[model samples]
Target chain A: MPIRNTDHAWGSINKAFHWILALLIIGMGFLGWYMTWLPNAPGKIKIYALHKSIGLTILALVLLRILWRQFDRRPSELPMPHWQAVAARGVHIALYGVMLLMPLSGWLFNSAGNFPLQWFGLFHVPSLTDGENPALKAIAGITHLILFWVLLVAFVLHAGGALKHHFIDRDSTLRRMLPWGTRAEKSSPPPAMTATHSTPNSSSPTEVKS
Target chain B: MKTVLLFVLASGFCASAGARDWSTDAAASKLGFSGTYQNEKFEGQFKKFDAVISFDAADLSKAKFDVTVDVASVNTANEERDGSLKDKEFFDFAKFPKAHFVTSAFRKAADGSIEADGTLTVRDKSKPVTLKVKFSEAGDKATLDADTKLNRLDFDVGSGDWKDTSIIGADVLVHAHLSLTAKAG
Candidate 1:
């Protein structure tokens, strides 16, 4: 219900951004795959335009989410082994990296292919490159495909980690991030200083302890 | 005043007589078009095309223009798009490999530019198109630059599902620049 993250759970805003972006990425994966095999028709072109628009949207949203994370508090790390904690950090970093690279490569491919990109046909995004270069286009295309696969693998691992915490580790790692999960009653209220005023510069001792 | 009027008429007739037959220098001429696809503009040219031009600047009625373009020679610099354009939904280059245009009349417009009225045939469909042309003469050589616009759908260029103009625009602008040398009589 809170707009900012707590030491115990994710806030409403962060959860919304996560779930919406997750759904968009999954839908885009299907659209990107299916549109390639579609016969040369108006419908195919329409589908391609939709795919590009959604891809651009994801790119913009990811950038905003990164900026938002800077100011908001992250939930305290769940109790785990040292190696697990390190692995979790690695996966998170990889996910963010792929999220940024995937759309960038796609944009470069479109620009080099001399294809015009429009976001829902409202306006045009200027091409990043001048003129057409088939070689650059091909390379960017291959890079995009490779990044998408990386994202897919990262996503699977991420989901597996969350589920592992929920069922095996018996922690709130999954539940605390869920939009509709019931908040468990706290035996002692969190310190007032750590409640709602956490800034990017404020790293509490609790985070250090975790 | 009467002598001056007679001199002016005589000079006009001499100029008409000097307007000779011209042949296109194929290597120096080009026929191309540009169209929008997915809101992006792309240029394409017919690698093989011929234009027959005969004109007398003093007499518009005696002018004639004819052109033939090999449809399969369309090169858009993109293989995938070129391939699709030649398919049944678009140019249908397999069944119709050539497009032709022949002018019926040439007139001098109010702005002093030449205009040719012709029927352009593509994919078995013919539609009347008028080209705004500018002609200039230099010694024994002449240059002709012309442009026109046509709706691809009118010529059945992209039929069936390809008729959706939202993806591929309906309007195609064609351009031609020709350098011609007067034939020795």
Candidate 2:
């Protein structure tokens, strides 16, 4: 596949960035929950450090992905009802917002709680806030938890939407975003396209954007 | 002229005769320590401590120093770490909240610094420790600066998982800077 997105399909670069970030976010969610109840020990401390390091990494990657999205062409919305289109756009925006906010709140909590962050024991990230304030720490902690729940719900909805598009809608909405998959057969395009396209579908392996 | 000379001699003799009691000015004094945790250095302090000192520079045999530190007052700025430090495996603040240090002998070192041979008691465990002290007096104000190093394991500071020095270091550096007011006896 090409590195740039076409109106019909997402490019390889965007697919890679999306899937890798998805995996990391899921892993971070598990780590965050597990580390909270861990007994006070050296192992627990190390795991906390690991969690912080990964959260920071996700933050940086998401920022770069946002910048990349701004410059790169995005696949136009697949055929759906006008309301569904608007809902999809809203979900995309919410996902991006949660991705950015979650890491930031975690960083703020660590700073207010006076927990020093070292990136994989390589370099220290200086705290954004000064001395420890219990009040700010508690607030940040609560904010972080709430954001995680938001992210979790949004994630489920996103995955469900993708599966619905594949199994029920029978559209290229899911397959186009896959890292590797069989090309959509040209002989039998879904019936939904016939209403919009005047020309008979070509026999080429690649689907032409309407 | 004769009376003035006799009074001067008597005053000079009196100055060297007795040890004066010195009370630490708590507002101006600090008792702090630092240790390595996971290869990163962290600083902490005891917010409440009292030092009782009596000394005369002219007489080393008469000098005495005693200090009491509230272990529960440990502030590392990180509440979680501070909470763990006060538990049974560490200072055990609930059972033994105060750490005491008392000097048995005072001697002048070759480098002109004073050395106090002392014993430090923490969590009911007492260990012999020596503090290299530097003393200076100006008018009615006196300053005492001392530092010493002690192995945390020696006093059973961390019991089970903490005994691994690779994670939290074994040696803890303790230092004190005391500003004292001397009361003439």
- TM-score top scorer: 2
Give lDDT tens digits, candidate 2, residues A1-210: 778676456777788778888989999999999999999988898898999999999999889888888888765455666566556666777788988988899899998988777889899888868968899899999999998888888788777778888899888767777777437423226564553353322321222121
Per-residue C-alpha lDDT of model 2 across residues B1-185, encoded as one tens digit per residue: 99999999988777666477898889899999999876777889999998889887878787889899999999989998899998898999889999999999999999888899999999889999999988898889999999999999999999898888867899899999999999865
TM-score of 1: 0.86
Q: Give the TM-score of candidate 2.
A: 0.88
**Cα lDDT of all candidates, in order?**
0.80, 0.82
| Each model's backbone clash number | 0, 0
Q: Candidate 1 has which clashing residue pairs, if any?
A: none
In candidate 1 the C-alpha lDDT for residue A83 amounts to: 69
Interface DockQ per candidate: 0.48, 0.64
lDDT per residue (tens digit) for residues A1-210 in model 1: 687787666777788878888889899888889999998788887888898888889889889888898998776655556667667777778788887888889889988877778999999888988867889999999999998898888788888888887788666667667777446314213432353344333432222111
Cα distance off (Å), candidate 1, residue B118: 1.7
Any runs in candidate 2 off by more than 4 Å, and if so which?
A: A181-210, B1-18
TM-score to true structure, per model: 0.86, 0.88
